[model samples]
Target: MTNTKRKWFIYSLVGIGIILISLLAYCIYLYQVINDSRTSEMDTTKTQLLEQTSYVDIHSIESFHGTNSYHVLEAMNEAGEDKLVFYPLEGEQRQLTVFDMEDMLSKNTLIETWQSSCGSCKLVNVTPALVEGEAYWEITYHDNENNYVMNYHSITDGSLQEQFKYPKMFY
Candidate 1:
């Protein structure tokens, strides 16, 4: 091919390569934006639920028979509302009001404050009484026919410890 023709061909190939790279980068950027938007949306929705809700009733906390396993059940309730008539376990349980919920569900905190007797808990241990080092949470969300449930499972010293998950959707 002539020198002029070869130069034009080379320039054309370079231009096409640049265009392709730019398009690929834009697509990747768009995907990241959409993913981040979904995460932010979920966080906002969770905060709104926390604002409108009130309290949680921990129903059962039991150790698996002859095993280092345990389970806990809790129900979230609106403050100042009376729905059930179950016997008290310890002292009187207090309902969390809107204001209280706001404070507990603050952002940047991995664990909610109301999940424990004290507001302080390690991220590794789902239980407040125990402290963990390397173990972390393995979260699972299930939507069964009846209800939406979540579980935060952690393993420490070969024992499985679980924490109750709040309802995803409120009535």
Candidate 2:
């Protein structure tokens, strides 16, 4: 081929390579910006949730059975009168419970009922939550071998409304 033609071909290849590299860098920068925005949005959502609920108090409860250890938390719900929220720290199944704070504190009927229902499981935390305009209790419990269980018990009758078990692995 002629020298001029060869030189033009090389120049074109170099230009294309530079353009490709620039595009890749731009894509990477865009991805990072998007990821950061998403993180910020999540933080804002969490803050909004806390503000909407107006939790008066937060409590952490820890329990152990044999070799298993359980971590639970309770938060008072100011948005709803006589309500508490409960949840567990880490597990395949995370549970949230909202129940009548007054009944839980005074009568302790929910705890008693839970004991009766699952003798092997121990209550970890109780929190009040508003679910679809209805008040509910989120209860976290730990059974044998560090197994985490979550139960939503009705405040009216202390009946188990929903339940979940933590998965062993995330993926």
Candidate 3:
């Protein structure tokens, strides 16, 4: 090939190589950005759920016998009677079924000597010592005798601390 023709060929190959490299780099950067965004979204969701958990009402069933037979479980809404078995404290809400309660209560500490209302109640093995100054504590219990178990943890350092699970017999 003549000098000019050879030069033209070489330049064409170099241009194609540069274009290919640019496209590859862009694709890699896009993948990283999407991955990072997804991770951040999940973290935000978790934080919101933790915050909602702090405000749901957790009370003793012993105190509720005369008030209302239909006790609304916390983290759950009044519609559909769905129990808040698990969810981000604020974003998504899920119900706890009868089987779910039974599973959770199976490991709970049964309050054998209680006389107020929950005669055969099962509570999580959580004590004041486990919660006093801590920021969170996971508690699980049977929502009712029907075998619905509700599991939840509390956020202790904020305005929502009053909703922390105290020993209760709502079952």
Candidate 4:
């Protein structure tokens, strides 16, 4: 309409744009901060394993957070044997638990055991995990109804220890 009204409208639009840009920048910064903390934890676990155990090499490390925090490293021992190193983050005394991979049930075998009962579910990746100092294989998958599921099975006996399911909220 008038020149003064158009100027006011443009100023309002600029202010809103500035606010949105600031919000986006803050979210990106927050995400980076959280990611850095997790990466640092993984690095600390690797250093601890190398110093405190006979493990000579690490193939991979997976971070797990539940009742407790843990970093599970697929590693090799001084005797050239594949091992799993579990380093717990919470406790008065934190000790590294080194397990022989051969002694534990294989991922394929464990997956087969679960698959037999959940034929219609879709399997996701399985990672080595620890619960209260005991070693377990954590399996993540989507059920037939599209609900997210987590099944923790004992590595020694291949028995299910616990399961957590999260139903999808949005279509």
Candidate 5:
């Protein structure tokens, strides 16, 4: 009877292990589905973007989510001038706006400002964003304490627009 009870306990543990593995697999599947959906939406936008814009070559496309969401495209025009195209996402109450890269404040200047403010922060990315019809450089970084920080600065004038700092939840 004792041997039988031991076998039952082992079986129960194996069953629990299987269940955990299955749950992990399902979670991974869900993450992939969400990521694919996001990329597919951008693919659809690029199709429409080519039709509505005159950019000769599209270098990169990045999605920015904030009070206003947009697909910011870095492209080159006919005269070989680099341009930043702000294509408003569907359901957004905004029109397409494009800017000559030269018209905007340089990324280097934005980084310089970020460094002056937080000398110990480690930068993640400097993304171009369009917010409420205004162009901004969205800076993502990790503070000295490893807190996630997002700083938005006006691309037109190189002034701080907004900032959010998210503290690290775990060591």
Candidate 6:
């Protein structure tokens, strides 16, 4: 073969080899980036779960209010008292009510008292919670159309402190 032709053939082979090596290196870099991102996401998820568990202490309470539309969960605080946490099944608002157990048991007239104070909302359930060492009532109720409602009433004065309402559905 001619000398010039032989030189061109060697250069072509070198170029092809360089291209292949570059492609392989790029693939390896992409693999490492994807793996690192997945690991970071998993670590973030684990951390969020741990923080949530530490925030709410789980408790065993029977006859919690609501059907498939809402959820009421009981948790024991650091003071060894039950706290009621209310949230809608698909809504955004969440409420935490803390009171004393003995105060709730002695207040049998709480439902009747709430009925007159809460307008048309019917009393559903009453859970005790303690707020800053002060006992309060976490009242759960529903309107005529089954819309969920919550009221935080002071145990001492029977005055409403906070109220929450959630509609039946969200589009």
Per-residue lDDT tens digits for candidate 6, residues 1-171, read 699999999999999999999999999999999988865644443343336644345543322333322233455556666644433334454333444444443346777787776577777778654445445567888887778988777866677888788888954
lDDT of 4 by residue, 6-96 (tens): 9999999999999999999999999999999989989888988888778889999988776877788889988899988778888968877
Inter-residue clash pairs, candidate 3:
49-88, 49-89, 61-169, 61-170, 101-148, 101-149
Runs in model 2 lying further than 4 Å from the true structure: 1-107
Task: Order the candidate numbers by lDDT, best to worst.
Answer: 4, 5, 6, 2, 1, 3
lDDT of 3 by residue, 53-161 (tens): 4433222111111111111123323333322232212223342211122223221232332213344546544321112323222333444454534333332221223
In terms of lDDT, the best-performing candidate is 4
TM-score of 3: 0.35
Worst 10 residues of 1 by lDDT: 64-73
Q: What is the lDDT of residue 124 in candidate 4?
A: 84
TM-score of each: 0.33, 0.38, 0.35, 0.81, 0.81, 0.36
Candidate 3 stretches with Cα past 4 Å from truth are 54-171
Report the number of clashing residue pairs per model. Answer: 0, 18, 6, 0, 0, 5
Local error of candidate 2 at residue 21 (angstroms): 46
lDDT value for model 1: 0.38
Candidate 1 regions with alpha-carbon error over 4 angstroms: 55-171
Query: CA lDDT, every prediction?
Result: 0.38, 0.59, 0.38, 0.88, 0.86, 0.60
C-alpha RMSD by candidate, in order: 16.3, 13.2, 18.9, 2.7, 2.8, 16.6
- TM-score-best of 1 and 4: 4
Query: Model 6 TM-score?
Result: 0.36
Question: 1-171 in candidate 2: lDDT tens per residue?
Answer: 699999999999999999999999999999999989855644453444367556655543322221222222345566645444443334656455555555653226667777787788767886543445454456888876557887776656666788889854543
RMSD of 5: 2.8
